[model samples]
Target: MRMDWTALPEAVTKEVANRIDGSRVLPATAGDHAEIAATVAGARGKVFVKAARTELGVRSLRYELRVSEAVSGSHSPAVEWHFEAAGWLVVAFEHCEGPHADLSPGSTDLGLLAATLQDLGGTPAPDARLFVPSERFGFAHPAMDGDRLVHTDLTAANLIVTTQGLRIVDWAMATEAAPWVELAALVAWLIGAGHTPEQAEQWLAQHSAWHEVDPAVLTFFALRNAEKWALKSRQGSAGWMHDLADWTGQWAAYRRRPAN
Candidate 1:
């Protein structure tokens, strides 16, 4: 149900055009998502627009908008304007320009990402009923319960390498959980980026948030992550999904091994 920006209903386009003070809408090439996205060029400047036309899109975009509004700053985009009419919800953001993070083992972008994660961890989790990672993983451990605002999806694609620094976007899957949760997820991503499981943990461990987590809890989390990804990988999805699942599975196995 993805609609091009130019093809969007007249009402939705009109609203966006008014907000950006633009006379025309130039739709960006679609990504793998269920929403209409584009950049509108106006007299003032250009602003990015993402709109949801379906019920699922509405719910997802609403959550994304909420998180964007909650954590307003350079790290996250601010919602310039938002409106819902004719069964469509739209929000405009200050366009962040840059390529996705280069997560290769020795890439400098990793340093920037470290800084970004540190800042995000310090940001208080919004006072909303966000999904808890512990519940999603069915972990009975108490360590998983805390009020840290975690991006959850820490893949390279989610981190944009902008001039200021690395910025985490795609808040649609954000959740409230332990401060160390994101670090744990990054461990898997790092492995996917060609770092050994041990090296990944070593790199993320430099962050203070990772220090706050206990060893036993981390072990449990690794086990659960391996289980989740392993199941998904078995479903026969090709490419990154399967590759990431393998990477996470490797990290879990590494955790299970006896320390020298």
Candidate 2:
């Protein structure tokens, strides 16, 4: 079931109208269960609007607001400010300008993203109870150290290349977890995208300080993610399922090879 924005309570819409000075609104990008776009008032400048109604989503938005406030002075791009009113979480951010599709992985822009992640990891937010234990440890591993906050959903859609560099947009799934685990997940994503294990390892080693963790962990996470993608593909597109099957066969063959 999808959320219908028009069904939102009247009180929420009025609150949003009051926060931003203008009534003019434009349709923006839409995510799994939310719609995001830019808003403007009469000469007051622009702000971001994110509206959703799912219970989990509301929790995530509230947490993101806290994290954004906590890291405001740190200069990290992962953080953004959001407010809750009229049953919607309307967020105001610096109107950043950039075309979204052009920012791809492995491009020079990724360097800035890497730096942002590094800074976010380095900032210790021990008191932030934004992420529950189960949600934080559920994805990659069974046991998480719970040391740092991680932007768990780091997909291409969530990354925006702005004038300042790169900024991560979605914060609903961000949670506190072991830093290495999140890094491992990123490495896994790189490997699944066709990078050799060695190449992925080298890339992570150069990118983050917590690169000494077992490489086997990264491979495990990658395989897990691959299986999930394959299952989803089987449901959505036959061609994707076929490609995933072929990739799985190649992965098995590579796994059987002796270490050099």
Candidate 3:
């Protein structure tokens, strides 16, 4: 859905120009979501902007802005401003410069990422209405209840490795769930980064949150996530979604293996 500045409506472009002082657009990375993703250079400085015209996209971006504002700046980029213009919902965030985190095995980025997650675990969910794991996933579980804010999308692309530290982006999928949910989400990312499911869990076990939850619950989460991703992939989602389905399936399989 990524689009260049020229793709925006004339009215939208004019509004953006006013907000940023001047408009020099550098289209952001091509992500599956966000119709207008770009870094705008202004007389003030650069600000990353995400704008959407579709109803779903607009709602998602607005919700993301709300959830993102609630998160501490240490964990996410600061929201500079947001407004609606000519049917587009646009939000600007402090421009963070860095490549995405390297999740491959033995990468130093793991430590930075782990620290960010640890800090996030301590961050309380915003008072604003947000989805809890059960509601978000459409399955009830007592273990899914918690007050901590959870960013379910832990893909490397969303984890910007800035000099300040690892700053997580894309809060559209943010949830208020148990501290363990984020760790659970990380398992699939590790698998995609070339770690076997067992190896991923082994690494995750070093964290306290991993042990706070029942192993049975983790297995259930893995199975449910795998089913969700697989269904999405089958339903004509992006081709890369198949990789998510595969990674989550591997984790579920590992968890379901009989104890020796």
Candidate 4:
């Protein structure tokens, strides 16, 4: 996924410049995603450009663009435009400068994450209903859905710690789901980020959305996510993926069999 700005086709570079009205482009190799990524600078403006030329890359770009278009919030970076240029799928986002969020236990950013999620949970889901988590993952306990949009991929890499506050980036996994559902879904990532099952629960308890969730609903999501992670672990992933699957299972186990 790492690629230099100069590596892009000249046609793409030209279109990118046209999009931002920029003449100078500097490569920004910060993210794990984006094939032709850089900071386009010139008289018109400075913006972050992300693009990909592969079929899957184009498809993924469209998904993210649509999802990004669905929400407008302080938690999200403002996107300038999304379009195809010289056979490359591309999008330009307002250039935001900050380090990725630190979600490790006890970090101040964790509170900021809570605030951001709270704000995001309040936003209604996009009207098009492009995807439905209920239909996707049929929890044995039945679906608990509402109009709220959910960002399923809330990894540290996707979060930015800005002077204003915590902002979430990357909406490729956005889907229609209950806000409380997202609260429940966040537990595994919390565990993966070094929160003990107990600590994660304590943190989740502070959120009003989690308070409204029925115990069975929480159990259903935990069990379902556990199963999903279990399968993902078997797919030959290493390191964090492997550890995530294990941590998620352990957290589910704790939830299933509470301490005496």
lDDT of each model, Cα atoms only?
A: 0.78, 0.56, 0.85, 0.76
Per-residue lDDT over 1-260 for candidate 4, one digit per residue giving the tens place of the 0 to 100 score: 66777777788778877766776877875455567777788777888778888887777777777777767878877889877757888898877778878878889888888888888888898765446775545453445667788887787877888788887877766778778777776777788888888888888887788878787767767777788778878996656668768877977888797541
What RMSD does model 1 have? 2.5
C-alpha root-mean-square deviation, candidate 4: 2.7
lDDT of 3 by residue, 219-252 (tens): 8888888988889889975768899989989988
Among all windows of ten consecutive residues in candidate 1, which has the lowest summed lDDT?
25-34
lDDT of 3 at 110: 90
**Higher-ranked by lDDT: 3 or 4:** 3
Q: Which stretches of candidate 3 lie over 4 Å from their true place?
A: none
lDDT tens readout by residue for model 2, 1-260 = 33444665777666656666555655455455354444444345455665655677666556666666555423334333455665576665554456552323466755765777777676565465667435543444644456676776555556667776677665666677667655655553454466665565566676554564554555555466556656667677555355554554344334345551
What's the TM-score of every candidate structure?
A: 0.88, 0.71, 0.95, 0.86
| lDDT score at residue 234, model 3, on the 0-100 scale | 96
Q: Output the better candidate (2/3) by lDDT.
A: 3
TM-score, ranked from best to worst? 3, 1, 4, 2
List where candidate 4 sits over 4 angstroms from the true fold: 1-7, 21-34, 43-45, 134-141
Candidate 4: minimum summed lDDT over ten consecutive residues — where? 134-143
Clashing pairs in 3: none
Which ranges of candidate 2 are over 4 A from the true structure? 1-10, 33-42, 73-94, 101-106, 132-146, 188-199, 208-210, 231-260
Clash number for each model = 0, 1, 0, 0
In the range 41-67, model 1's lDDT, one tens digit per residue, is: 888787778888778888888988887
